[model samples]
Target: MSTVPLIRGYEVVIGLETHAQLSTRSKIFSGASTQFGAEPNTQACPVDLALPGTLPVMNRGAVERAIRFGLAVGAKVAPQSIFARKNYFYPDLPKGYQISQYEIPVVQGGKVGFFVGDHRKTVNLTRAHLEEDAGKSLHEDYHGQTGIDLNRAGTPLLEIVSEPEMRSSAEAVEYAKALHALVVWLGICDGNMQEGSFRCDANVSVRRPGQPYGTRREIKNLNSFRFLQQAIDYEVQWQIEQIEDGLPIVQATVLFNPDTGETRSMRTKEDAHDYRYFPDPDLPPLVIDPAWVEQVKAAMPELPSTMAERFQQEDGLPAYDATMMTQSLAMARFYEAARDASGQPKLVANWLMGEVSRRLNTEGGSIEASPVAAGTLAALIGRIVDGTVSNNGARQVFDALWGGDTDVDAVIEAKGLKQMNDEGALAAIVDQVLAANAKSVDEYRAGKDKAFNALVGQVMKASKGKANPAQAGELLKKKLG
Candidate 1:
């Protein structure tokens, strides 16, 4: 049995505050382009840089996309909400404050249900709200200097806060991945981890089950799921050691170092009063009418968990296969295409999980960029099903077809990869092999092991490996008998 470490008769409690940048065409307030990788400060807008004399304006697309997410999670969309100014001074935050929703977020109280190892857990979301992202500070390779990039400033972001209900790192990762899939499916966020479009901030603490909670450490800006798990594991162990040494945990903001597998303090954790949050008098409160909310809700796409269940029930797939296929929207679509074209859902799953995924991983390709078209791939499988080629022959055909450069059937015919199914054709080669290896043939007649396989290999070599294995075995057995 596996035991929960640091159980001290206590459990580790965690909450995740994940931020996903909405994939909108424009900044939340300005018409400046939201495209990434621009020259530093080039993408900065008058409103984004918090230049004086600029009035705050809302982005309708961002608001609508946020509503789509709230409805997808069955959350409550508040009819009215205020955009408060979170006061903090940093070079990146040129305005000296971040315009964010605090007390009255746009949505509240929903649950995200997903499966992990056959068990389903519902992670309760406290709220999801829209805010403007801050600029980035480049600290590395600056030679004792720091560079500020305002490219991300004022870009729209949806901050989803989950309740402290996760028990393990795997559970936290599952919850984070589920939320990531949710935003991507809704077309609200790009869900790009390497680009920092989607990020997780984990709040970790340990407590005796029957006792009150302990001071929690907030680890900010964990960019990958693997890093998230590592950060949580190291933090939990650190907290347990501190408690055992009679050292109380400090409430502080920390950063996780994936290279070192450690969490270090960044700053003391700040309370609401620390930022001196106040309603921004510059911007009016957002009033979302019912009709508009309904429109956004109606436009919402199917959530991932729901789609996964459908793939299992409707596609007649195993739970694991369905779950793996539905991990991303694009992958799920690819599976559906192959399934529809070939009418072989199980084969589609196997190919996707096996060679297809392997090649994709090796070449750093996505489902959208795969060289093999779905229809073409399904056709190749059909050839194998009809016995036009053997399994090994199918692989050669696949390689030729995978580049989208060659016709599969033409490749097979050009290479003469068709199976040698004629009994007479295989019989001639078998007799030649048996004649060449009389001692082995005599041993086989006397019931010696491995003689038959040796003879079979000879026939295969004589036919240049195009001989059908089953038919060759049958002819060889008849001749030997």
Candidate 2:
């Protein structure tokens, strides 16, 4: 069993609901473009506006994307799924209801696997349903009147609902990231939190260990992973406090304010019955053919987990390194190019996960935006392996290559960072150091290891760090003997 997070002796349980905007050029039910940042109501068509004479036509591209997602996650794509009218009223909703899959969703019963610490966790998914997004409510620019942007109103979304299996905020964020990576990798969503292409709502509840599940309050629209963690942590503590103070934790929807780092109640939560979901009279049932599913499966890219396992088996990398190398398709591709070019898979992995990843993170960029190319990094590692440069000298070459189009050999030559591999020259330097440091040599003959190290340091200093440390150590040992 998975361990639950205990805060002040109470267990925190969490589930997530994520909405991933499909990458179709057109909206789900209309020919309206799903483009972002358009003028309000300009993108809405007759079907999106819910005119009396209009009807919705399902976009084949959107359905194909959903099928692609189901294949990627190993979920069951129902042959027949129904769309229902989710009855609700909001200022931004044009039709006074949302067209969504409620009772019979398109994709059902899959598990997303992620690593939390060292333990591999699989969060069970309930369903991923196709839904039409509502329009946005714009308030800041409108002088006491709200503006509705219908550009997002008819956007296609796959609402992925997870079971209440998460035990803490950390696990929840991991689940979110894994889901985000999966959808983006499948080319279904862009995974842009800033633009709301992918967003999560966390349902949090606290109770005694082994007790019945407590009432859950949903924290809505956490667009950032950092905000997701903060919101859940605060909500868990707030619920525990409420129980202790003899206050009932009411079931309601709340919004997280990132600046204040707190969540405030928005409105009372509604159950499934409150939505008044029913089969849409206007739209027919969504039927996916088995042959169509097979076609999508044939074209699906290799999943991340499958690629990670292959890395372990072929590259001899540890589990963690294999998983991290497959964090994104770009990163994995980079690793492959470097490894093939250098003929040193392990060395390439080291450089990528070490210096390359560090610089990318510091610059707030990704592997796709890296300044160092795979061939250039491969050349640098080759120099190190051929004894042309020490690990220290290779770093110098790497620094010069980063953010520049300079050649590896040019940097090595310009900086004069080549290792002194000449056995004759290094032997002469070792003899001079030995003659100059007679006391150290005597101390070394007297079985003092530090004295021997001092003599080796003298050799490195004499040659100005050009002499390879391994060669120096060997020459010094021969002279002392």
Query: Clashing residue pairs in candidate 2, if any?
Result: none
Q: Rate the local accuracy (lDDT) of all candidates.
A: 0.87, 0.92
| Residue 316 in candidate 2, Cα distance off native in Å | 1.5
Candidate 1: worst-modelled 10 consecutive residues by lDDT: 1-10
RMSD of each: 4.6, 2.6
Residue 277 of model 2 has an lDDT of 96
TM-score of each: 0.82, 0.92
Model 1 spans > 4 angstroms off: 1-10, 49-52, 117-119, 208-212, 389-400, 403-405, 410-481
TM-score of 2: 0.92
lDDT of 1 by residue, 258-293 (tens): 879999999999998999989989888889999999
Which candidate comes out best when scored by lDDT?
2
Worst lDDT run of 10 residues, candidate 2, spans 1-10
Question: Could you tell me the lDDT of residue 256 within candidate 2?
Answer: 97
Candidate 1: lDDT over CA atoms? 0.87
